[model samples]
Target: MSSNKQPVINKFGVISSSYYEKLFKCNGQNLYKSRSGKSKPSYSVTRECILKFNHTENLREKERLKEQLTKNILRCKRRLGLRTLGSGKHVNIPGGWIEATYLAQCKGDIQEEALNVLYDSLDHASFDYCQLPALFFVAESVLYRLCCDAFQKTYLYSVEMKLAKIGYLVFLRLFVFFLHGHLGGFKAHLLRLQQYLNVLSLSEETYYKYPNIFSNVAFILKTSEIIYERVLLSESTFSPNGNTEGYENVYSDMEFQRHLRFNQGGYEVNHLLWHCVAAWSCVQNNSPKLNNVLEHLNFHKTQLQNKCWLDSALALLVLAEAAKLNMVCLKALMDLVRDFILSIMSAQNQEESYKVNDFSWAWNIVYTYVTILAEICLYAATSDLRKTVFIGFCGCKSSQKNISLKDTVSEDEPVLREASVLGLLKYFSSKISENCNQLIWTGYYGLVYNLVRMSWELRGDEEQNGLRNTIWQTLQKTKDHEKDERIRIAVKIAQAELNDPTDPFTSYGTKVPPNVGDETLSKYIGWRIANTLSKLFFPSIDACAVPLKKLSIKQVQRKYPKKKEDPMKKRVLHFTVREHPSKSELSMFPYPDLFTRVDEQLARIVDHHWQEELKIRQKEDAICEAEERKDKELKEKNHFKEIMKKREEKLHKQTKPYELPPRTEVISLESKERNVRKVTDYRFSTKIVQLQTGILKLPPSAIQ
Candidate 1:
């Protein structure tokens, strides 16, 4: 062998060189090597050689090896008196005998002898079967087989002991997984047991004969209950650690456990088990002596509710089943649930109130109980009995003012909670026909309104459609048209479909004639007529009517005024009347008529001002032209005066002005004074006319 051929080390860190040499040499030869002379080998050496030879074999060889191994282990146990009580023959035990015995027991029927053999193997103080994973696997398999085989037998102490041992083994496996940080394995083991129990429960023969199976069933239930309680209690505390806070970690751990249990059939099994136990106890004890069972169930329920964790709905359902089994004390149990529901519904303070998600679970529980309560009432014989129980359950006075439809749903309570309460009332009404009239009327009407409004708002989609139809059918039963306006509104909205169109606005097919009498019809019509008349002619009716007719007459007179005798009088009449129309006519004319008159007068004023402005402009033009001509002449005269002055100065410089030339003066066709007066008069007249028209011609832009 080369130096690089490294030896394989065990956990103890030392490899047996001879062991490897024999192994490699056997591999090369495809045959085993003997320790001494090549004679028949010792039993241990033969076993090792067979194992090494069969390591590469297929299924046929593997099964052959398993049978051989089983034969050897059983032979050894038999020789040592491990299969019998007080036998003197003793034989040394082989390694892996525990696992071999477990497998052998699982492969066939576990008879008394096999059980005795297993017991003897396990009883050794130095036995290490529990530490071996393969031993657990083999033991679980054998236990499962044993349970199936014994499930049909009569109650025997030995069978019960076997079951107890199997259960203990299962528990040990779970604990090992937990301690070793193999949570997945732990959950898988739990699930495996859960499935095993379910199969056990399904066997009616097992349950009927072995009433003590409750012990094994209780083990599973109690394990789940304990884990759930820990989870619930943990959620209420704070965790300072990083992975999860204190209570949160507890919750997480429990939740993980719960997932295991639930996935493994914990819910169905535990609930059924509790009821089965209670029922069996009832029959066996010949009395409702379920205090022990009830106490255990209640402990978990109280924890669930107080912590507001775990599915309260599922817990309540289980409790209700148990309560049903022990019906003698059902009222007290029911009262406890009722109080829980009411307290959750009434939690108004922000801190006290359950979170929205929590409330959903709480409501589910309450609603379920409410349903159960209704069933109980309906099954009662007499109306009086039903009524008494219903009133007691509701905790409201019979004579108290019923909640009206007009009263808004409280903000603190969920809509589903309100719906549930109404459902209860409706149920009570159905059960106690004679005494439930008031409740029926009030509850039915309120429900109709709520459902109708909810439908209109499209809150619950398809669900609300169903509710709307239900309310309609319910309304038909009561036929109380006077009290329920929602019914009336629904009818009116559906009236167009009296002929039964394919669709009604209410979407409830077509309207069916309500069973109302002529008296009711007459009263309804009379009320409508009175309402209309009062709205038409109430306070100050005379004042409005008198002004209306007088204004009409004034408008007629103003629109068709009598022809005036004189033209001047006609013009004055027209101007004065147009300037300020009659107030009565203005007020009475429809808004459009008043607007038209104002528009015409504004147009006329604009035209008059336009003409006056044109005349003033012409006169100004004439006067400006005349002034320009005069100013030109004045300029020429000044130029001539300058020439004369320059000539005189030159002449004096020589001798003197010799008889100054005759002075020439420019002339005009019209006098400046006369023209100024004519222009001023023209400007004044234009100014007066413009001023008068400007007073009448407020801008159309302003009106707009």
Candidate 2:
């Protein structure tokens, strides 16, 4: 592998000024299909009538208009059974993005087209029952766009803030079904959303003062991206006409990137091995980006660990794989980690306001950090990395000087003596055969190595099992390892990758997977070497994305808590904390019926038509059910009659009793003697076959 060049990121986070896109993706998705998003007939008619009535002062004229309006509304309601407004007549859109953006790539075009039609209708007005999936998609897109627009205009986002909040509930449920787990390509779509989150959490001030939805779906998506960008990366270049699933490939796959978006994207491999996709992208000829992800972490918050626990832990863990970028990066990371841990232990002056319920993050942080250190240890164990590199990476040289054992221990707290040293380090170190009797600690290398070794032992855990297997296959270079499940399902997946490192802007079909619609061979030794060296490791990047829209919701909810159900009914209730919530939770709430008179009339008409159709279907189902029941009854009767006839025949054949009673004389000998005399009359010697029938002689009730 060739040596890596150090990236020099400017204050703008710019590493290179080659052919590329701007910092923020400002190109809007084309949704303008040039078709009129016409208002509902009922809405139009009612609105016109009200306008006309308002203009007239004559009592007789007013009364006549009102009557006429009522008649018109009724007529519209009766006709709704034949046609529903939401069925069509929405998107005759003119712009390109509605049907040809990243959202509509591949087979998703048709689904997207239908969705756009509904979005066009919804963007004009409000109606929930008209269409649900369309609303979900549009609302999510709107929420993302709102954040992006905020980045563009900054303080000018006040107008749509209310609308965005209302749409958040809709956006919260991004997936229609959880069973199929992230079926579409959300890489490009989620970038802007994550970027917005990063801006909100530039500091810890906004996070604690305003508890938001950071712990909600946004963080889940952030983590999922980390795994995806790190694990499922590809070296295959991008293709404009990539989607070949029968739909017109109208999507434009031009990717606009920068350091800001890169940090938000996740992961940054180091100079020791190779940079991750985003970091490497900074060196592109046409367009280059920087690896300035470290700037995203909150150093101030990490310094005060106990004050901002989750944020600090996350910042540290995110840089686990990244510390090996260089000696400078490694040293800075080691110092930060050492200081963060010391802050957790020696916080005697800080107040303990948290309860037991809020203490799981500390354990989770330690476990995760130890596991990452273990991966580094494995790298060091092999000749892949030097122990000196791991030294700074593991913070072995750093020591907690100011806070000694005596500073932590006191006469007032007897337990302080036992808690002087962290037990996790002690037990974990013993496993690696390290001496723990030394007071106040061993050197940084010993402590970090033990943690890493413990991580190696615990690698058998279910979560890391698949990664281990993949690493083994890579090392062994088995033929089966080439057959990844991703390649098999590649045809089904949306190949509209605009920014993945694997799917680059240009390619020579060198590192392409075997037979992925490609007839190329892996004979190029140069290409193999380049691809092999690039896959050595990936950098763990963290942009500290936290959703801030929830702050508005929290402010509102806190000021006016949700109302109780039927306060009048509960005449007497037990005393509670803060009863009778403040009134008017929603000053601008958009109820379906809260539209203008025209829309309300239209809603009524739509409801009436739906009811009429439902009634017709219900009647049809009833008739079908009755006919089926009648047919079943007749068939049962016929079957019963056949059984009865057979029973009557056996009962009337009284010879059965005589035939069975005289078993000795029963035609037991149908031999040659009987054959010889068979010519003569033998009416009483007839063999009975009735015994073989074994039919039940009881009625249905009797059997029961």
Top lDDT model: 1
Off by over 4 Å in 1: 1-288, 291-300, 304-315, 318-328, 346-348, 352-358, 379-389, 393-704
lDDT, candidate 1, 1-704, per-residue tens: 12333334332222233433332211123122232435331233242433333353577766665666557555646543443322342432322333333333322232333444444443331212223333334344444554555554564444344444444334433322231223332233334345555565455444322222333343434444443333222222211111322334323222222222222111211222233234334433455445544554454444435433223433343333333334433544455564554455355234345465244334323433543344333333344433333344344553122232223334443222222334344432332233333323333333333333222332224433443443444444434423444335433332321223333234554433322110100011112222221222221222221111122344578999987586555342445777788877676533444434555678798889989999999999999999999999999999977777888687654323555434342223246667888999999898778878885455779769
Q: TM-score for each prediction?
A: 0.22, 0.22
Q: Which stretches of candidate 2 lie above 4 Å from their native place? A: 1-318, 353-360, 380-704
Cα misplacement distance, residue 408 of candidate 2 (Å)? 17
Instruction: State each model's CA lDDT, in order.
Output: 0.38, 0.32
Kindly list the per-residue Cα lDDT of model 2 for residues 1-704, writing each as its tens digit.
11122222222222221101111112221122122433221122322344456567798987786565545433332322112322334322111112211121112223233233322222222222212223333443444444444335533222233223223333322321110123123344344345444554342332221112222223333343443443235322221122223212421111211111113222332211122222222322222223242332222334324422323333443343333333333344445555544444344224363342233234334433443444443432232232333232233333222122322333452221111113223222222223221112222222332332232232334533433333332222211222333222221111221112342112322243322111011111112222222222211122111111123334577999987798567576776546654456434443332223444587688889999999999999999999999999999999977776786697864343334555555566556567768744353243223323544244579669
Worst 10 residues of 1 by lDDT: 516-525
Candidate 2 structure, TM-score to reference: 0.22
lDDT of 2: 0.32
